[model samples]
Target: MFRSFPAMAFRTRCPVLDPAAFCFRPSTDLRNPETVISEPQAKVTLFEAAELLRNDEVVAIPTETVYGLAANAFSPAAITKIYATKNRPQDNPLIVHVSSLAMLEEILPDHRIPPIYLPVINRFWPGPLTIILPKSDRIPAIACNQPTVAVRFPSHPIARALITQCGFPLAAPSANSSGKPSPTIASHVISDLDTKIPLVLDGGQCYFGIESTVLDALRSPPAILRPGGVTFEALKEVLGMEELQVYKKHFVDVQLEMTPTTPGMKYRHYSPEAQVVLFEKPIPLGNGLVPTIDNTNCKGFELSTMVAMTILETDIESLRSSIAHEVEQLLSAGNRKFGILRTSSSSLQDITKNRGSTFKSSTEFTVVEKFLGSALHPEQVAHELFKCLREMDAQGMDVILVEGISEDREGLAVMNRLRKAASRIVTM
Candidate 1:
């Protein structure tokens, strides 16, 4: 029988205020890898940290997806706390983050990892790719509200450390409230989730701000499960495999109204308390999330170009020219409080000028490329978009429109962000 998630805090079994649950320590070096606490004496030694997690206690573990409120995958009760704290939908699955291929065997039932996927995993694991395979009888169906579970081996050191110390695989999801921006820093987890969860291990910010790229390799056709750190193009580029696009149903579960599958699918996930809309065609409107109704009652919303576009791929110079043109349209529409931020590609160039390097190491170029660039693959671009948006949002901007990326490979995942991040959509 599936267990009911606790509605209240797990204070009795696990006290949040207990001194034994937390320890403080001082480290002047801000970049130290093992540093978990900010204040002196707040750092618990590894022994204490292991005991804290082993006791079915909640600990905020950092991952590339966001900080996950980790619980032993084998402990249903402990896992329940994660659901309770996040207020996540029970039907949505929880991803299992393992430390290594060896740890994966503990959860998997000797099923051979797929041959095609082997190279994909080799190229992507310890990073952001989540693969869904046949579930063992051992898997709890509640993980993603699906029979097949999502699993990944995170590349984050602190995330792996907590799991190794506890000696159990962890079922984790993005630590913020479900459908919110994933927590990239320990402070982010603390800000959004600290009160509800137990201890948060303060590692530095995540290199990649979005969730992992998820693919369902168990199926014959092989579905791109969910787009994140992994891009579909990267997968194809690395493996030289052919990808068949799967058209996802817009509304599978009515409880979500019209949200798609996956955790954030049921609701408007990743919105920063601001409304986002997507437009099939460009519209010069700045209103957040209100349904756009044409005279004939055709409904639509403006999306950040970042999410809704499958713009022609070009070089950095052409890309910049195109964006400057778009930005002019947005500015002409009376949308002010303006700023443009780029985490990855900033060009408007045609796709012909693709040079597979990460920011070719010049400050002036990184700045220029951030605003105007050429062809950008999803994996290359998805790395920094969210964090850039959040920072831009903080600068007191009202409406921000971003361009979308190609929908091949990890592009599927990039398109996911483009769809979700905008308060509206305008496909140009």
Candidate 2:
């Protein structure tokens, strides 16, 4: 019943889907399902995008979290194009996107949603939460051969409309090159995947600006494989998720990484071309009363007084000194340009003023600073993290210094991505 669209023919026949022609109201709420498209041209564009998917062509569609490179989940041929286009690792599995619970039922092995996920589904469906379930015969093994497949019900109207129009579950991953930062806006997808895929349904900027919170409810205690838009606190509030565990740096699983059941597990993900250096929050001493600097690689700089101050007090100055020290070291290695992703509300003027007082005039390196929202509001940080990384990378920075945030709520997911992206971690 399903026909495969030849990659060459699909590319030649279908012109790039223009974002100007296709626009939708930006909303993440699942209950309110009114009109999504603003212009009539968007309807025609949506149909053309759906047609490409029906014919097994990979189409870039926007999700509430990020844009996804989608293809028919049932067709191995279609899924193959997704892998080739993105150069994604074969071992890393793709998450299937569904429009409704009925579509989700069609992909399960027994045509029944897993009992463990019923409560979670009720609360977080049509959101940024992804659940892994047993795969049916219809879903190709290339999608996920490990007996289970990761699936999501995206709240983005264009993504939902496209999936519903195609009349099938779509296996879609973040519409960017493998291991690179995920695309939050349609332009990010077009920039990374230009000429690689046929159509990218431009649904404007994604609300979450990250990936979905992937949960494997099949496991005991139900661990979150990858944290994203959904916070652990939110999921823990769910009826059966009181004991939800997150697979993070402290909780390392070798077997899971070797054969990841979900995406963002086994690979070096959320990275930019420039080297990322993450400055983590200081950890408390063994007594949990006093804070201690775990590591600060600033040689020849005095940090005794800075270390004595409480964790909260050691904010901007400490970070500036550490970054200046790092830049000085890199300067010896002949590196010129540097970028800093600030977590605080500090402005570029503040950084510039401090640079004059901090670094020697003789040090001839350029430092560009961009704020990633305040630490008080972690949601703003999450939304701006990847975009800042890409922007800094585009500016030809040799190194990027990211000031880490407290691991609470959305900060947990933010730190998770930073940990994976960072080549070096500094505790301050």
For candidate 2, lDDT tens digit of each residue in 1-428? 22344445334223334344423333433332333555677678788888888887888887889889999988888888888888887888999988777788877878888788888888888889999888778887754568888999987767887787788889999999988888987778877888778887777778888789999889888899999888999999997888899996437788888888999988889999998887664533332233222324221122344443444345446766676676567678787788888854432234456666766646677789888876667788889888889999889999887767667778888988899899888776
The digit string of per-residue lDDT tens for model 1 on 104-189 reads 76676675565767777767766787887556666665454454567887777567656665676788887777766677766666
Global lDDT of each candidate: 0.56, 0.77
Q: Name the weakest run of 10 consecutive residues (lDDT summed) in model 1.
A: 24-33
Query: Could you give the C-alpha RMSD of every candidate to the true structure, in order shown?
Result: 12.9, 5.9
TM-score of each: 0.66, 0.85
What is the lDDT, from 0 to 100, of the residue 239 in candidate 2? 79
Off by over 4 Å in 2: 1-38, 283-321, 345-351
User: For residue 128, what is the lDDT in candidate 2?
Assistant: 96
